[model samples]
Target: MNKDLEKLACKDLIDLALLMPKKFDDLRLNDAPILNELNCTKVVIKSKKQLAGKRLTCIAYSYNWECECTITIFNARPFHNALFAINKELLIYGKLNDFAGLLQFVNPKIIKNSGEITANYMIKGVSDKSISEIKKKYLNYESLKAYDLLDEHIKLLLTMSENSSDAMLLLNSDELNECLKFVEIFHHIRRLNETYKNDTLYKKLKTHDINKWLKSLPFSPTNDQLKAILDIKSDLENAKHKIRITMGDVGCGKSLVIFAAALMTYPNKAILMAPTSVLAQQLYEEAKRLMPGFVKILHFSGAKTKFMQDELQDANFVIGTHALLWADISDASLVMIDEQQRFGAKQRMRLKELATTNDVNPHYIEFSATPIPRTTALINSDIYSYSFIKELPFKKEIETKLITIEQSKELFNHIRIENEKNHQAIIVYPLIEEGKTNTYKPLESVIPYYEKHFKNVYYTHGKDKEKDNVLSEFALKGDVLLSTTIIEVGISLPRLSIIVIVAPERYGLSTLHQLRGRVGRNGVKSYCYLLSKNEFSDRLIEFSKTLDGFKIAEIDLANRKSGDLIDGDYQHGASFKYFDETSDNIILQKAKEYIHKLQDK
Candidate 1:
């Protein structure tokens, strides 16, 4: 075996056994067809003689056919002369050529029929005879029911487990030719897991009375939120630095769950860092309102240097933006980060390391407002602990509708009515201003129509230096706000009840869902209008029906065909090469099953 092959196989019996042959070369054919074709045969060496320039010539003919064959060897050694004896028979395999009605075999693999044993195989970079010998030495595939899938090949190294379902069934997919390839990949990842177990272990927990603390909350928690809290509770019960992620849709109460985690830590000082100052301040305010007065909460912002330093020393729960990284967190044992994906890995990790004490990693929990596919979660379960809040605490009464140019009047009327009811509305544009080559004027064209018809009008985009001020003004008093997808993640507007996306196709379903989530935060009626010229957007129609973020993720998964399973940022924004993590649940499950079977054996 080559060192590389040994390395891949790990010299493990099962691994070697599972290395299926890539292809096979047939050497069992006897005589070539009577027609003109090169072939193999058992030929008798009728005559042999040495030629000029270290060459040998042999006149031969097939034993059972009327055809003659010529065997020529160049740079012939003395051993060649001994092998090509007069009237000696030999079994040969190679391509033959008809030269002027004369059949000839040149430099063919010659196997002497002189009581010498031989075998055929087709492993790349390995001698065929050696592989055949290994097969001969190992395979004892005798079954009462005569197995066919394993045949006599794979059985050579692997025992057919009775628990394994029709292994061939797992490999066959008429719709996608990639099925067989995915089957191979599944086995490969399973094998890698045997040596590279990524999950960790930590010390057990003793004092975390979350039940009493949970009872103090004003509003009851959703089952999913409670389950996530329980999961975190279990994670913290141990001394292992609890690094867990809680993923939820917008308004799914992830903040409250983070609060629960903080209380679970109890005496262990807890600190949280948000991506934006606005988000940090929002969380700080919420924590103060819900948390007991005994829990001193501190938020550092602007030039509150003196007050910040004073609170840093006494605060039990500290919340701040990235600026908190510079503050002292020497006493913190539980560090929670909100909107974890928004921060850079170095920033997140640096914050994590800040809470580490005496080499004892602090319990770290992260919050994400976006939802990933379930299959992805399963595949990465080994990498990091994850909790999902798939459902919201309340069902949003948001109605999503597709609007066209023909229905432009109807859409405007609805927005006006929403505003009349004292609720706010926003119109999202694909562009802040029209490009010179743009077929249609974007925000510029709509400004006159909206300003002429609506009460207060405000517009902002990524380039607007005063965009934050515009957004704040819009949130406070503006009735109609024209913007870009920048409103997808931040700034919750409870009174904002309607969103009209001018060109829905420009954004993905996930992005659209994030925008839709911006509305109906206060349980008030909401409406989302997807305005576009393209009428064939069935994905948008389907997305309109489900308010559940997890369901929206499934829709998003179905639209994209390829992505990698893992990426550099610890599985964040990773794609898959062999299988779609969004749709290949069965394949991933089978891989997990195969690993368990191998381990049990």
Candidate 2:
């Protein structure tokens, strides 16, 4: 790569082609000058130039208009003085300004050749000349064709890079925008295709009677959950190794799908990794109750490692926390991760590697309770197989509302009423300890007040060592739980009917949705109060209207810029500059078709 091109972040021909000009200089000679607009005309220097301080003034006669105009150059260099020599006929381009009654040209540029256009780039440390040269060398048909771009796309890029009159027209047209969007998506997908591989061998699981297993379940599986299980079932039966993600809203019954996948791979071992110990314990208990007695199930976490070695030998289904990453295990035909975004890339990969035997990678399926926008799922589907479960097993009756400090009495009375019914409430604070500049009360200061006013008040945060125990106890006996957002993703509190988020504006809509999901479990009537100083926040107000996590994700995307959605290994960084994931679905669909056509060739 050329150093100058590297400075502009151009790694290849495609990148160089996409480097569009910031502006274009039209130097075509005009028959008549348009006032206050850029014009180019042949002019004759009429008088000797006069220098005042750093300014130079001269008179020039426009041959086309047959008028003499005052030309002034500020901070004139030696080249400016030479260009305006007396009696010299030259072509000059500048904004034709009419000051008061006199026509004037300020710092007019001498055009060596008229009837041409020049591209002006804004790249720092790289001159326009260098960019032009790079474009001329690499922005040709043959160069871009090597990257498998469609011929029409290559031509459009060439026209844009040429800086012609047609280029200017295309710059303002929607056609160019569509073409750029297609190119970006096409390039990204192709890059992923080149690097993505599924060469690892895997033993195909024999077909099992999943429908019969579903019949024995206590409750009927929703259509979405059944479809997701079927999707995973198909992947397990295939000879090729599989990678799929099952995403859904909170309480969408993704757990049943996990167990179904494990059952499908029965006789062959299956393993699941959860984000927290509490979640792992909950899943272990659920598996024991729901799974049939024939399947041997084992739970592994930091606390239960003493007997893991002996238990692993014949364990048909293993569920554990991050401690499973370091455990010695083998011969697992399938691997599943819950809340996949919570685990790092290395941790997930480590668990998958532990299950691999004879270089055969286990079939991997990740479950996400954090719902993403449909458009993002569509775009990402080109890289990984996706299954979305939108239907909840039961309707959640969560009534969300925005409240202010003045409404404290009303909020407290509501909590008291819930407590009278043997229901529980949780107050989520933004911080554990009060900061010097904090505007809202922290958990430390508010816990004492709750302890004084109410009974069975419990508090915990991310740094708390006994958080798992606290959450377990809170689920059984606590009336009110005062804590931070640590309870956002774990535990199933059946009696949790009310959740009050302090300073709700400090969190993203998706996060706020996750916190709101803590309540309304078991289909009980619940309330979510957004305890904020500013009650009229449009985001919170809009959030209070719907219980759809997917819709909240869309709203979050609309409210935030790119690169704020997911973190850790699942993050799709800001790779597409022109493709708007929010509104470019049509273009993405077209690009997928075009790429498929090219693949057929």
Identify the leading candidate in terms of TM-score.
2
lDDT tens per residue, model 2, 1-601:
5775687886567878888887788988888878999889898999856677788888889998898888998888888778889999999899999976778899888788988888888888788777887788767788889988888889999999886898877885688888888887777667655433455667688956777879988899999999998898889998884368888888989889999999999988899999888888889999999988899999886777876788887899999888888777777888899987576556776788888888777898888766444224433537567798989867889999888988989999999899999999999999988799999888898777899888889989999999988998888889999988888887898899999999998987767888888888789999999988874667778889988766776676656533522222344345467888768878878878887898788
Go through the candidates in order and give the C-alpha RMSD of each one to the true structure. 10.1, 4.3
TM-score of 2: 0.84
lDDT tens digits, residues 1-601, model 1? 4454364433333333344343332344454433334355778898877889988878898865666777888899888888888977788766777666777777778744422223222555677555554544443455211322223333323432211223323323342234333444454455334322333443244545767767878878889999998888888787553357788888889988888888777666788988766677778888889887778788877457556787788887888888877877877877888876466556776887786666666677778765444233533434357789977766779999887878988988888898898899988888867688764458867788778888999988877878768888888988999888777766879899999887888776767887888999978989998888877477888987888766776676667422323222442343443455555667667656655565587
**Alpha-carbon deviation at 575 in model 2, angstroms:** 4.1
TM-score of 1: 0.65
Error of 1 at 433 (Å): 4.1
Judged by lDDT against the true structure, how good is candidate 1?
Answer: 0.68
